[model samples]
Target chain A: ADVAAAQAASARQDSLTKPPRALGRLEELAIFMAGWQGTPRPVIDRAQALVFAGNHGVCAQGVNPFPQEVTAQMVANFDAGGAAINQLCRASGADLSVIALDLDRPTADITEAPAMSADEVLDAIRRGAGAVDADAQVLVLGEMGIGNSTIAAALAHAVFGGAAADWVGRGTGVDDEGLTRKADVVARAVERHAGIRGAALLAALGGREQAAICGAVLQARALSIPVILDGFICTAATAPLFDADPRLLDHCLVGHASREPGHTRLLHEMGKAPILALDMALGEGSGAAVALGVLRAALECHNGMATFAEAGVAGG
Target chain B: ADVAAAQAASARQDSLTKPPRALGRLEELAIFMAGWQGTPRPVIDRAQALVFAGNHGVCAQGVNPFPQEVTAQMVANFDAGGAAINQLCRASGADLSVIALDLDRPTADITEAPAMSADEVLDAIRRGAGAVDADAQVLVLGEMGIGNSTIAAALAHAVFGGAAADWVGRGTGVDDEGLTRKADVVARAVERHAGIRGAALLAALGGREQAAICGAVLQARALSIPVILDGFICTAATAPLFDADPRLLDHCLVGHASREPGHTRLLHEMGKAPILALDMALGEGSGAAVALGVLRAALECHNGMATFAEAGVAGG
Candidate 1:
């Protein structure tokens, strides 16, 4: 962490006219942004979202309401700029890129076997890492995959240390039967992959989009870029990174706490609070895209406003 | 209520590719915007915030930690664009207006006497209402005051029918002793005005800015202008308006649920929900200003997004 920059930002914060800690979390976020950017003044002036679209074999287990092809259909919608994330990104002045990392093929059913071979998992991570824009300061990682929440649940159960009931949620609003089936699939996958951990556990129970998201998160951290995470699916994808190195989370921010039950559980584990609480559950980085507005606002306040010394306002 | 426009907006929402009510409150807000704006395609393109600054006599009861002069000081901060609301307004592209309605003197101690005479209260309301801008489409109401939480708690307890303890909280992080004292003061004020209701209760217990905010809410409704409400103090001031005509709520949107305890109680009394839950209590329209971002996003998606028919995507 850039302690010197954080110190400078804090000094500015205390010099503001209001009482100490008058701005609350908003001020804390500014200091955090300063340290992350390694500057007393930081901005999310240039932001980009990468949508990693893929498919989950758990769809074969009758785990979701939508067909697997709907993933491709949604990807097309993102491509044509018609989806929720597209509108949010466009409205908030963030660039959007939809990448079909592995669109045509679904992962192997994790309940019976590993989702991908070790080599494929590594390649998926590389592909995810490769998509981060070198110039963008804030990188938002979102995903579009049908029945992927079940895989996310399995992954969360493995690395994040939660029961299937806690990890599984009404993904895409599954019916009662679908919910039961999804839980069963997650339970079986967790038990089958009990001995695995880290990248091996991710490869055993995670989706291609999830693995790629994991890679993107690591790459962004390595490049000293701050990452904004979407809801349950994306959070589940990055669970391995957070579990392995808690310090890596200093580079991550939760865009919103989704209505997905497992999302709160995961957020609790990460000890990172979301910037917005909009009850949004439609992933594909929709929460993160919407949150770009708050991020930009925080930056503007941190960098643009006059301090008590400058405004000639008395301190309390 | 612009029934035709609302129905048209709802039709567009249904025609979108997502499941019915899949977008949840986001779609509801869009439809609500259409009804309020009298157009199927509604946008909060031009928004403004009016911050009414006043002082509370409740400070004499040792109900707060800060001196009353801080209210005037904060007003200067608002004018110089150094306060939280100013920075938020600048960041979100909202016009900011700070009115020192009655800051030179504090309100009368509520436990011993009425905060304002009936004529003064009526005049305060008129001043609040007169600040509305006809050119603006979305109007946000916020306030600045010291020891105002005591008066707000009293107003909420008297108007919204809640226990004084239930309505009281630490404003600006008051110590435990200050909170207990504030509660005692609110309890006494509620007892003193036990027989009064509506405008009489407000005039007896409210600060000048609260009365003005009450006037602004009514004026916005009379002009068919949509209002975005700030936290506890403003809500307490306008409680009487909400009680008199619950239908007026159709034109108002709660910006966020303030950390102030009375805010949730008052919101429940009005049967309204906030757009965001940022846990902010800075007042001065700060919550409303940050919320401008969410409102703009909702409007953008409502007016600019393509439907299944427009995008040629399959219906779910």
Candidate 2:
């Protein structure tokens, strides 16, 4: 009751803009900013996606039909500039940076693939986030691990302390029976890491890419940068990060509502509003890249709008 | 059970895209285009707002301190392109068209305000909607009016056949006592027009602009051009139209879930989603105009976009 009263009072207090009631819309937006780290108005000096490319161990399950090699192939596709997420990011003015976080048994072709321990992944993320100029903000905390959803689900279960069977879902649209098997696999993974919490959960169940994203989200929040959270996989991994420190939610903006039912439920749990509901299940932060334009437009509208009082019109 | 089954089947039938499971992110956009007049993938070549500008008869109750003149001034503000809605529409590439429907008394000095009766409003709406190209769409809606909430409550009571007290709210932040007075006035208005259905309710209490908007929404639906709905005033008029003919739901897209509490329950009654939860209370079709951009992006993404198969990428 005390918290509710405080929130209500805050909601009313934030409505006080310069010249009283003028710029009501912008005033409301400023109130929304109170929940984030950025100065009430976030200027996107730079929008970047750190694609944590990796092949997951859970692909051994029949949960996903795609071959594990596609993870590296897609990484090469991103590097060669052919992936759809790459194209969309380019179109939307996002710089794509790839980190070869993990491929437990590396194939012969890509020998340069960086083998990162959980701590190394964290260090790399902090380093990448540090590379951004102080004035500019990193907008996307994105992941690109093949079969990472299983890893994400397990990590999320441990982080938020949810049941593995309840939190686990049909990643890449497995059948009802396949879903049961996937749940069992995730439950075993979660049980194996039951005592672990926070960053440890990432090391146990989190993919290299997922751990890197956790680092980026944490670093971005520390720097007051806005992190655009993509669909289920990204949210699943980051849920624990937020649970570890609720302040992390301050720097995040929900990119889009994923078609996966768990995604919207998780977003609601986190008190986020997905700017778009475009049913984007294709990962690699495709939805986040697209959502940037909408947020940009929203900010533009919030800033550029001529208030009713400014227009010398009487209020209704 | 029967209605749920039918809706489920309708939902399934709406998912038939050209290439099965190819354009994953883009396929969900089909729901927005499912009931358009043109081909399934309708081009939103031009979008227009049919703003129903009027003043409620019940404003005489002193619920709002602003004289009814603000309605006409705001309408002129919209015409002279000074209102927030105007700025937003200009930002979003929408044509602003205004109609002066059934204002009880216009403030002097506003030039050439069209005084439309219920009949004229219906005719103008049909004609205005028809003027747009077949591929284009229109959102028929209302903006500000003194004591508009009272009028809406009366209209809702008449159409949804609920008690007027159920729908009345704090229009423009009336005090608790003022709200009681406002509700009483609407209840009286509802009694005066008791059992009056559809057009007669408009003739009795609905403001000119709201009547025009209602007419436009129904005509647009009949003509098969999609109509995106806004807040309470527009929605109150909608009940009568949908009550008159249930088929109008086909062409409708609810833009924002209004800040007015009545709207959520109404939307649920109509079974709508993809609601842009903007918490918007200001009308003038601003919310719908913003939603139009979202819908346009969805349509464009749907119609344009190489399928995973087309792009020769392995499905994730």
Candidate 3:
């Protein structure tokens, strides 16, 4: 972070007419962006939402009501500008693209063995990262995958060392029976990979899209491009990144808190708070897309608002 | 409330690809608006933020650091497009207007007696309601007055029967002594105006700007135009209306929960939850101005999003 830019933002904030901190976290977000952009004023001229669509092997265990084909269907829906994320992008003036990663090549069910080999996870991450436009000022990470929440819960349980049931939730319309089956799948995954950790743990329990998100976040930070994180499956992918480098979150904003039980724990682990808390459970970066308006509005205030001296108002 | 329109919105929601209530309260808001607008796709075409500037009598109590002069100065800032709310309106494509209501004449010190004559309060409300253009599609209620939170606290305390301290909070910036003084002021006002309720309570404790906001909200509802409520002072002004007609709130959306303690109790009283909780406290309808973007975006999604059949995606 650029301390000089952040300090400058604080100084400018002090000159606003309202009492210091009246803007609350909105002020903090602006200051953080100012520092990250190395300017007292920062703007988001172009934004993109990258949807990583994949399929999970855990669906074989009847974890979710939807068939694996739903992932491919949602990807097509996104391409046709008919998905939730599509309308959100149109509303926020952000571009939307679907990354159709492998869908038929489901990995070994987490309850039985390691989900994916390390090479595969790393390769998927790199592919995910390469798909992003380096010129885009900001990115919103989203995912569309059938039964991916199952992988998310399993991964979180392994890394966070929680009871599997505590981390699992009824994702995408899972009934009580389906919920129990998902929890059982996660519990067995934890037992199957009891001692794994770090990158190894990621490869052991993560799904294709989850690995891609982890990879893309790492790439975005390396490129100094900010990313907005969506709901649970996407957030769970960050567990390994948090383990690798906590500061990686400096380049990200939590769009909204997901209703998924694991997402709340995952956010707690990241030590980040969401900008919106609408209990939004639908993925495809819908929450982050809605938040794009808020973030852009923050930048507008940061750049367009006048200081007390300029406004001829009393300083805070 | 238009039950037929609401039913249509619900039917349309069921046809969307997401599961029932997957978007949380956001979906509900769109549905409500669709019903109220008598269209499946209700949109806010023209929005306005009405900032009612006035002087508070309780400023004499040293309840805040800023003097009453700041209210007029901020109104000038609003006219110059220099305030936070001005930037917010510009970002959201909403019009901003500054109403220079009588400010030199502060209300009677509420700790001792009534703030304004019943006629003056009612006239202020009428004046406020008239300021809103009939052509405006939506209104965002805001206020500009130092120590107005004291008036808000007093009004809420008298109407809601809470302890004075529960309703009192730092308005602009208050020291520990000032906070205690503000709370003491509220306590005294609550005791002084014991059993005063409804329109009578408003005249007894409300500031000029507070009364106007109340009037504007009521007028908006009468015109079938929706309002987005800002922070405590503006929101507290509506307590009597809530007591009189709970249906009036069907036309309002609580933009964000203010940092003030009473705003929570006030929203709880209104039986509504804020769309955003940014902890924003500086009012010029700033929170509501920001919410205009979300509201517009919601309309965009409702209008542009394709249903499951249209998108050729599987139903929920």
Candidate 4:
């Protein structure tokens, strides 16, 4: 991060027409952007939103309510501009793309074995990283997979050293019986993959979409493009990176606390506060896309509003 | 409010490509807008934002940090498109207007006498109501006044039966001493005006800007335009109306929960949850303007997303 630029932005915030710190987190958001963009006044002219979709083998355990084909169908819907993320990205001025991560192939069910081979995980990550636009100022990451929430729960439990039930949640409107089965699947998967850690743990319990999110986040950081992470699935997908190094997420913000119970717990474990908490649990970069509006508003006020001296307004 | 339209919108939400309630409060927001707009698909093509500025005699008690002239100066800044609200409104696509409510004449010190007589309060309300745009789809309300936070605190304490210390806060960055003196002033004012209720209570402790907010909110309801209220001062201004009729704020949304200590308590008292809580305390309709972006996103998804059958996606 550009510390000097962040300091400059903070100094400018004190000079704004409003009272000092009156904009609260907005002031922090603008300064954070300034640091990442290496300028006291940062603007997001190109925001790239990427949604990675893959079918999960965990569906064999009946953890998800939706069919595996729904993942590919949602990608088509995204292309047709008929999904929530599409509307949100359009409203927030983000250019969005959906990448289907070998949807015709499903990872091995985690309950039986590792979700993917190390090489397969690496390839998925490379695809995610390659999809990021070099010219984009910021990246928004989300995911689509039928049983990815189960994958997310297993990954989170393994990385955070928590009970499987603590990380499991009803994804996509699962019933009470489905919820119990989902928890059991998570427990069995974590136990089967015991002692696996870091990237190996991810390969053992994560989905292709999850691995891709990790790649996209890392790629954005490498290009000095700040990232906005979507809900539970997206966050859990990056948990292994955070496990390796907490500072890996310094350039990212969790967009919203999802209604999925595990998301808030996961966010708490990561020591990150989401920008929005409107109970939104939908993935596909929708939460991050909606939060892009707030980031835009922050930067607009930072760069557009007159200083107290310029406005001839007395400061307290 | 059109119940049929709201019901239709809710039903449409269930049919969207995503799982049920995956959009969470965004779904509720769209349905609420539908009810107010009397359409299953609501759109906010024209949003009007108003900032009311007034001078406060409460400043006489040394309760404020800035000079009373600052209110008028900020109004000038707003008119010149150089203030925070101007930038926020521009970013959120809202038409911005500033009304200086007789800033040349400060209201009587609430600790000494009622802030305004019945006639003066009524005139201010009329002016506030007259400022609303009939064709606007939504109204955003905010305020500007030196010591108006004290006015808000006093009004809240009187209406909610709270201790003066509970309502008083360091508005616009007052010091520990200023805060103590402000709380004392509130106690004295509320004690002197004990037993006043409803609109009379507003006149007893509220500034012209506060009363104007009540009028504007009522005017929006009359025109069937949904309202988004700014921070503490705006909410406190409309508290008396809420006290008069709990249903008075049925068309309104608290845009954000302000960092001001009283604001959260007041919101809890009113049983209203703000759409955003970014720790914002700048009450120039800035918070409300930012929240308008979320409302816009909600409606966009509600009106634009393809249904399950349309997307050929399986529903849970």
Candidate 5:
């Protein structure tokens, strides 16, 4: 982070027409953006949102309510601009891209073996990293996969060392029976991959979309582009990076708290607070896209509001 | 609210490609707007934001840090499109207006006597009701007054039967001494007018802005326009109406939870959850304006997203 720029932005906020820190978290957000953009006044003229969709092999366990084919079908819906993410991106002024990662070739079901080989994880990461637009001022990362919530639960349990039930939640809406099966799948997957650690744990229990989110986060950080992470699945996807290095998420914000029970716990484990808490659980960057509007409002106020001196207003 | 339209909107949400309730509060918000707009798909093409500015004679108690003149100065800043509210409204695509209420004449010092005569309060209410634009799909109500926080605290204490200290806060940056003085002033004012009740409490303890907010809220409800209320001062201004009849606020949504310690308690007392909680305390309708973006996103997703049949996607 650019300390000098952050300091400058904080100083500017105090000089704005409003009371000192009256804008609360908005002042902190503007300063955070200033540090990332390396400018006292930062603006997001170009925002990019990426949705990575992949089919989860864990569907063989009957953990998810939706069929595996739904992943590819949702991707087609995204392409047709008929998905929630499409409408959200249009409303938030974000340019969106949908990337389907080996939908026809699902990873090995984690209940039986590692979800992906090390090479496969690396390949997905590369694909995610390559999708970043260097010119974009901000990035929003989300995912779409049939059984990824179970994948996310297994990954969270592996990294955070908690009860499987604590990390499992109904992804897209599941019945009581499906919920029980999902918890069982998560428990079995985490116990099987208990020995794996760090980023390799992703290979053991995570899917392509998860690895891609990690890659995209890394790429955005490399290019000094701040990222807004989506819901539980998205947060669990990048947990490996956070576990490896706490500073890895310094340029990111959790977009919203999801209705999925594990999402709040995962966010707490990561010591992150989401920008919005509308209980949204859709994982197509929808929450992140909505939060983009708040970020834009923060920047607009930061860059457009006249200083006390400029407005000839008295400061308290 | 049109129950039929709300039901229709809720039904439409279920048919959307995403999981049931995946959009969470956004779905509820869309349904609420649909009920208010009397349509299954609501759009906010003509949102109106009204900021009522007034001068408080309660400043005689040294309850505020800024001079009363700053209220008028900020109004001019707003007119010049240089304040936070102006920038936020521009970013959120809301039409903005500033109504300065007899700024040349400050209200009576509430510690000594009623803040405004009953006639004066009614006149202010009339002005407020007159300010509402009939064509507006949604109304955002905010206020600007130098000592309004103290006024809000007193009004809340008078209406909600709370301890004066519980309703007092350091509005717009006040030192420990000022906070103590503000609390003392609230106690004295509430004690002085112990018999006041319902809408009459506003005249005894509130300023013109508060009365105007009450009027605007009533007018919006009469016109079937949903209202998004600003922070503590604005909320406290309308507390009298809520105290009179809980149903009076059915058309209203608290835009954001304010940093003022009393605001959250006030929201709890009224059983209203703010749409956003960015810790914002600047009350020029700034928080409500920011929430307008969220509301717009909800409506856009509701109106624009393709249904399961349209997208040819499978439902769980």
Candidate 6:
């Protein structure tokens, strides 16, 4: 009855009010709701970007200039409190946790994150859930890895079921030939995992970082915590997340639309709307971190604003 | 030397062999420059809500329940300047301006806005340009006129080129019969002005307030001032402004994607990107005015954020 009434009211509203003007007002209302709903309060514990660092075997194909060693080294840098992502996390009041998993070699005290096995992914999820404070939500996610995009694209294709070319993109600025090779490699991986589906797809082609992100996202929702989705590659890795559990979307917010074409398609497929669209393609959860500021402002407006009725003004 | 070096360095940046992080950091530099260029002192000039008040001749066809006299009375209320929009403006650090352009009755200093003749609109453009200070900008544009949406839809059809049903939406809760009449009225208006195009279509079917807005927008751009476009009706009315000049787009930051289907089409035609999407159908430029708060914040962030280099962080 309520839904029917609301629908009827909306139809009546269409009949009564002017559409353009009303729609403009509604957009403001949605922003208000998003900002209000996902507002972050200062808790005793800090938020963190759980960067699950990993490597793809496909990088051996010379898809990127960086060696697999850089992934582990960067993990060490993050653990040693160096690196741009760490600095951004520091600036945004987020704790930096570097988890090295799926690498041929690993770093110390950075948590021996297992490879993208189902059990390892599940353990990562449990760990992320445990790490987050009861009073605060976690913004756990992945970081840079050589050929991570290929792994992510393969995972997305297996779960989302589109052509690899449609899902795969030029990760880390590939040349035309490299892009074709990257797409082919991802397609082969997707084809290899045709039998295993859903969360298993995360296990197959997803980087350790991506598997950790999938775990974090699932766990965050179970704990009633909110998550901010970053760029294309990270989002691709987490594609199996929605296929495994649709409810995870309720606890997530898209931070920004990337300049990459795939990111927009992913956002549309997930039925998510981004908060900002300044053509962001950076993937350190940088856009999401910036959006956290806007989210804070939105909450302030909703919680603090005096509505028309409260302010003794005519609303209509 | 610093400026030259910066430009020269920027020219050579693409060729630089750097990590992926370098590209991510440079875009912010462009944003910072753009924001800093917009304002030097970054003082918040209390904004003004200028509501153009007028009436459409089509209202005489029994297209609305409210008598055309209401337009003049609303103008008087605005002249006394105690309308809801006026009150909200005053409360939100916004001054209110009531330009009684097409009121049935003459108003004293309600600002003699003649019938939306081309000369009048051009003069209005000059007047709108004159309203802003050298350092400050007006952040809102609104209107209040009886049966104005008829003019709005006709303008949308003329500019956007679609069926009347596609563009002509319910203006003010008209019933099925009323909607038919409203569509018929708009279709006739569109047919009547087949030869007329752009601003001329607006002048023929548009209300006095709309012409003033068209003028205001043009002037705003000439003076490098920005205007917050309101919802469906206001957008429909302003459609011709874009057709008249494309440079005007730089000055228009769409506040919301209005619910009216026509509004979305109009926004697309104008090449203005909306900042919010709430399905709001309210007018009076309230949505646009509210969105300015966020735009201001974006400007602040762009201009004021400390870069990695400045913050003594590693760029790569």
CAPRI level of candidate 2: incorrect
Which candidate, 3 or 6, has the higher lDDT?
A: 3
**C-alpha RMSD over true interface residues, model 5:** 0.7
Candidate 2 — which residues are off by over 4 angstroms? A1-51, A70-116, A123-138, A257-259, A268-282, A286-294, B1-28, B34-37, B79-82, B100-142
- Candidate 2, B77-166: lDDT as tens digits: 677765656655665567777776545563211111222355655664555454444445655354567667666666676676665567
Q: In model 4, where do residues sit more than 4 Å from their true spots?
A: none
Question: Which 10 residues in a row give candidate 4 chain B its minimum summed lDDT?
Answer: B307-316
lDDT of 2 at B180: 80
- Model 5 has an lDDT value of 0.92
The per-residue C-alpha lDDT of model 6 at residue B34 equals 37
For model 1, the docking class works out as medium
Supply the global lDDT for candidate 6: 0.58
TM-score of 2: 0.80
What lDDT tens digits, residue by residue, belong to model 2 across residues A162-231? 5666666666666789777767777777775567666555556656666667767766666666678888
Q: Name the candidate that leads on DockQ.
A: 4
Q: State iRMS for model 2.
A: 5.4
* Chain B TM-score, candidates in order: 0.96, 0.81, 0.96, 0.99, 0.99, 0.77
Taking every candidate in turn, the Cα RMSD to the unseen true structure, in Å, is: 2.0, 6.6, 1.5, 0.9, 1.0, 7.4
Model 6, TM vs. native:
0.69
Cα lDDT for residue B128, candidate 1: 85
How high is the TM-score of chain B in model 1?
Answer: 0.96
Give every collision pair in model 4: none
Considering summed lDDT, which 10 consecutive residues are worst modelled in model 3 chain A? A34-43
lDDT of 5 by residue, A68-137 (tens): 9899999999999999999999999999999999999998999999999989999999999999999999
TM-score of chain A of each: 0.97, 0.80, 0.96, 0.98, 0.99, 0.77
**TM-score rank order:** 4, 5, 3, 1, 2, 6
Using lDDT as the measure, which candidate wins? 5
Which portions of model 1 show Cα errors greater than 4 Å? Answer: none
Model 4's chain A TM-score stands at 0.98
